[model samples]
Target: MRRFSRFVCIDWSGAVGEHPPGLALAMIGQAGAPELIAPKKRWSRQAVLEWLHGLADAREDILVGLDLSLGFPFIDRGSFFPQWDGSPDSARSLWECIDRLCADDPHLAATSFLRHPEARRHFRHAKGDTGDLFEGSIGRLREVERHQRVSKQANSWSCFNLVGAGQVGKSSLTGMRMMHRLEKRIPVWPFDPIPDSGPVIIEIYTSMAARAAGLPANTSKIRDLATLERALCVFEADTPAQLDRVDDHATDALLTVAWMRQASTVPALWTPQLLTPEIAQTEGWTFGVL
Candidate 1:
């Protein structure tokens, strides 16, 4: 299959609670205006799948980026451990085939689409008293999820609004977590802080080492952030400067960190590290490269 020449950004909502009066699909090409594809509220899942199938069939070598993770990841540790405890296939299917894959296989977990440098900058931890806000932030997200489930206006009426609610909840939770974690907090989504002038490209050069190693595309080992960092480093190093438009300072920091992450796969790479030993000793572990 041919990759898509253009980008496809999906702001998706699982519609766990509400259904909007109409479904909206916006398709933008390299040139010209965006095309809207809205189908009736009565369309069945089979019909929707058929339409999507046709859409995909029509495109040649298009890089079809989905808003949803193609699969689910099976959390082996932490709060969600003990794993799938005899859960039926329905749970997996309801979560979407890709998400289910991620849940069943550890390797297929996908990163959030908002991975640009600007986006990552905004996701910094909060400072001072709220230094450990990740937990609270998650709690807030659970609350938001609960609200969606019970809100009549949301559940009975506006289906499309489900996406809005989910986005709001996620943003709220993530932002709150950032604020709570602040010894000196940074913005989690600062588009305005960046200057609009000039072509400033933000990227994450992820390593395809796992993929290249013949690891299944949806394997259990591909979810580590460290693995992704290595990919990004390799990707950035191999690509020429013309491909990037960001300022040298910002690009350097990003690339350096990305390269440093290669240590996850090769400890010897740490011999000539860019980050200070002290900082690396503390912050390095957080990158999950190991």
Candidate 2:
């Protein structure tokens, strides 16, 4: 496994506003516990992009885990949207297309992209407003998500469903925009081969990292300082100096960072049995699902 100077986790949001409270960032250096970065301000997608660009500029050796899907399901139906001709064939292309369509959107908001003709046909909107090409009940699961289900880990929400608390549609699309913009500076795992050095981003299900700390699926959230310490102890990580638990995002990112450090050393995690070259190029894999 390649050693990293830091491990970071970003709990992203797809909300319409300039800065979303749901967006959170946390990181741990080579020698200390995980700490939230800029915990005071409501983070805008653009701010997160600037932060990542700074890290890339510094040539930092870090493994960043973003809590959002990198790409929609492509392999299951041979293309992300089989019926539509505009569907991107690969993850990088998908990000590029999303970024292009949402270029005018402020704070990297993807609502504009959702208004696109093809997008409206593939995603389920408000009640009774599902797109014609939207797949089954929960929509199509990416290959990694299917394997996640088989392994009894965190099963991801379909990027096709744009409604409900469980749906990650908006968040994933917005994050895809960030990925597209960051790719030139920072490499995204699977979509871009694991780089020899510098920062690399990977899709992560917070539940998977929480599970690594011995938390069950039903109680994956770590909201209080005590619970946060308990999870960190599982990795023998030091307790964070800051103890603000205003929301679950802080602790979730903290636990994820500690867990990511441990998971990064596992050889099998880097190469899951179910991950294929096609899947890597199309629907990217989550970091700790294996």
Q: Which of the numbered candidates is closest to the native, going by highest TM-score?
A: 2
Tell me the tens digit of each residue's lDDT in model 2 across 1-290. Answer: 68898999999999889988788888887767888888346678888998899999998899999999988998888998787788888888888998998889888988778898887888899899998988899888898888788778876778899889878999999999998888678888787777788888878888887887888888888777888888899987899886555477878888888888888888998888888889888998988766
Per-residue lDDT over 31-67 for candidate 1, one digit per residue giving the tens place of the 0 to 100 score? 3322233455532223433444554444432222122
Tell me model 1's lDDT, rounded to 2 decimals: 0.26
lDDT of each: 0.26, 0.85
Q: For candidate 2, what is the TM-score? A: 0.96
- TM-score, every prediction: 0.29, 0.96
After superposition, which runs of candidate 2 have C-alpha atoms over 4 Å from their true positions? none
